[model samples]
Target: MQPPTLSLIGTTPRMRWAWTAAGVLLIAGWVHRPASAQEPAIFRGADLKLGEELIAQHRCAQCHAEKVGGDGSAIYRPLGVINNAGLLRGMVEQCNATLNFQMFPEEVTAVAAVLNRDHYRFKD
Candidate 1:
């Protein structure tokens, strides 16, 4: 008493091609999506490599180590004041201004993005 089952076994070659094309399109859409599409809106298109370089050039970890001791990674408290992408970016901007790093807005965003990827993991 099994119900009728739909099967592609006897389908036309054209129908098979259409199904293949649809699957390809779906996979391509997912694969070719912009990297920013997966990141927080504020950090969209931020250059992570530049951010890493800036962090080293500015000795940010060294400064943080001086402030909080250890490797300075402790300064990045995911459960502390910075709880979102926007706040994380603002904190980087604050550092830029306070330390007179002279970083552009995009640079600040880049730094914040690296931090988010490494620590905060903020989706929004």
Candidate 2:
């Protein structure tokens, strides 16, 4: 009886180089992947500072506080009906319309991005 054996000794130099390159590429892809890749595409390149400023300037927290009480963060409802990134952004747009904020499309995306980063944390 003979025991089975595994060997890479037969592999050519080119084959070994190819395998090494593949491994390096795979590792690099995982390492360089953007953290925001999981977030909705609409959130990409959004101005977070502008969003925070708008949120404060518009007194969103103040209004929410008046409606839901406390710091007003309770209205977020991560598990509530306003689930998903698109819906969250849409809600912000709705607020903009209803409040007559007249914010530009990028402004809406900014606000939604800030909200997603802080409250909703929607992945996509």
Candidate 3:
């Protein structure tokens, strides 16, 4: 026997619209799911070793120690106002600018990411 015709499959505009909507939803989901997942997590793919090296070169911990006393870790208040990834990165960038560390953008990001991994741990 032959298969049902398009007229028989979707006799009504509502039925056709429903199928269209379902198709749209499916395609939209297929397109969007990967995009959302593809977005790199804060601190993802960071070079920890380079970050450490840069921190040492910049005397970041030393300055912090002088500023707050102790190993300088005390200067990084995990519970203080800088509680987000963007803020954390921004703080590092600001420090980079003010300190004139001349760190590249990626270096700054890597440094901030390492700091986040070690102390901040800001989850999206």
Candidate 4:
């Protein structure tokens, strides 16, 4: 037996277009799902630009450079003691407290999210 073609199945042009559109939508949703799922809830909708600006304003790199040398990114130990996303956020909050940055909770979360995106890459 042979399979039926679109012509044999009476598929109109409009129906073909609808099927194509539905497939595209499904693919699009699938493609974007993993990224959102991987992102931590605390980091969702985080202001990356604000985080970057805050890092600069605080001279975090300069201080880290003074402490650890190089461009200061070396201070970020993605595989080191600060292992998980919660720990990463806690470390950022600890830094804020110790440095008297007085950052709000959301700001701390934003900074941690930026660090995760750039370095740590914790899926959860």
Candidate 5:
């Protein structure tokens, strides 16, 4: 026989209908996609390898996938609000703040640079 389902706090019943409703609400909150790459010289000095390592260590895709589905890449709207190098850096800062990543300035920049190379493709 199957075991009983746990609740959100581990003290209540696991309602099938409740989970479905939550999922529906999530699908209704999609954000806009940003412009991919096309940045200027500010990105010229970025370290691609370091950026890639930081992203892997932080598991950015894991979190994104959990929220937006499809391997989590859909959450990163390359052609959305982050149109330039400065904006890209700022977005990374926002993510760090929101998620309490506690990364230093260089680490944040590295992560963003890597993301730009692989996904954003912003020129610099």
Candidate 6:
């Protein structure tokens, strides 16, 4: 038996043009889609490894545990006031300033990015 194939027989030029246009549009949409759709724009190109290291170095979990009374994981609330990526970064910056961490802007972004990856999962 022969494999089935699409038959263009008797198809009008307008119909063919419509199909071609639809295909082009579909392909263009896919091709033009943002590559970092899975990651927030603020955290793009952030150093996740450095973020992890800084988190550990800063004893963030220990501090959180002291404040919240637990493993410190409760400090991260995905649906809380810090819901979006920008807000999340802002929160990190606030912490850096309040704690006198003296972290650079990129370092703050890196920390926020790691927190987003592990806890918040904010994309955008």
Give the count of colliding residue pairs in each prediction.
0, 0, 0, 0, 15, 0
Which residue runs does candidate 6 get wrong by more than 4 Å?
Answer: 1-33
For model 1, the stretches where C-alpha displacement exceeds 4 angstroms are: 1-22, 25-29, 32-37
For each candidate, what is the lDDT? 0.89, 0.88, 0.82, 0.89, 0.74, 0.90
Please tell me which model should have the higher TM-score, number 1 or number 4. Answer: 4
Candidate 4 lDDT over 1-124, as tens digits, reads 4357756644777888888899999999988786556787778899999999899999999999998999898899988999888999999999999999999999999999999999898877
- List of clashing residue pairs for candidate 2: none
Query: Candidate 2 or 6, higher TM-score?
Result: 2
If scored against the real structure, what TM-score would every candidate get? 0.73, 0.74, 0.65, 0.75, 0.62, 0.72
Best model per TM-score: 4
How should the candidates be ordered by TM-score, best one leading?
Answer: 4, 2, 1, 6, 3, 5
Summarize candidate 2's per-residue lDDT along 1-124 as a digit string, tens digits.
Answer: 3233313422557777887899999999999998667677779789999999999999999999999999998888989988888899999999999999999999999999999999988888
| Deviation from native of the Cα of residue 95 in model 3, angstroms | 0.4
lDDT (tens digit, per residue) of candidate 6 on 72-111: 9899999999999999999999999999999999999999
Cα misplacement distance, residue 26 of candidate 3 (Å): 28
Alpha carbon lDDT at 92, candidate 6: 93
Residue-level lDDT tens digits of model 1 in 5-90: 53533256787788888999999999998765568988877899999999999999998999999999889998998999999999
Candidate 4: which stretches are off by over 4 Å?
A: 1-36
List of clashing residue pairs for candidate 1: none
Strongest candidate by lDDT:
6
